[model samples]
Target: MSAPQYLVILGMLVNVSFALAAHGTARTGRNNARDNLVAVAALAACLWWGGFFG
Candidate 1:
């Protein structure tokens, strides 16, 4: 309902999208640990920002 919440939600959406994209990429014979790590890092950043800054 507030700005922080909205941003958090958006961040979560982005992380989810990235995960889906990574999954697709992996299925297409492009699976890589580096890509997966990036996605996980994004999710971690989102959670950290939302939890601390909010």
Candidate 2:
């Protein structure tokens, strides 16, 4: 696969990881979930743009 595809996949994983982490933390009443969600969103945005940015 090309670099763009790799980036997309990596970014996607990062996004998913953060999402899962946030979900887990939610049960503890922690407030970091929002931050993780934001980071995940940013990663996903990068992944989406990487496909056409190159």
Candidate 3:
């Protein structure tokens, strides 16, 4: 894949890892919205960069 595709892939990985971390932390009563927001933002960026508009 090209650079942009690779970046999107990386972003997906980031979102997944962050979500897992957030879930784990939630189980310990240490989770927060900010963590989930960051993942959402990354997913948005990835989708935008992936050309959802096109």
Best by TM-score: 3
CA lDDT for candidate 2 = 0.67
Model 3: per-residue Cα lDDT at residue 22: 70
**Residue runs of model 3 more than 4 Å from their true location after superposition:** 1-26
Q: Which model scores highest in lDDT?
A: 3
The reply for model 2, stretches above 4 Å from the true place, is 24-54
Q: Estimate every model's Cα lDDT from 0 to 1.
A: 0.66, 0.67, 0.68
- Candidate 2 lDDT at 11 equals 78
Clash-forming residue pairs, model 1: none
What is candidate 3's lDDT per residue for 1-54, written digit by digit as tens?
Answer: 477767766776786677667764646477665677676777778777878534
Per-residue lDDT tens digits for candidate 2, residues 33-52, read 56776776786688567764
Using all chains and alpha carbons, the TM-scores for the candidates as numbered come to 0.45, 0.45, 0.45
Model 1 Cα RMSD, Å? 5.0
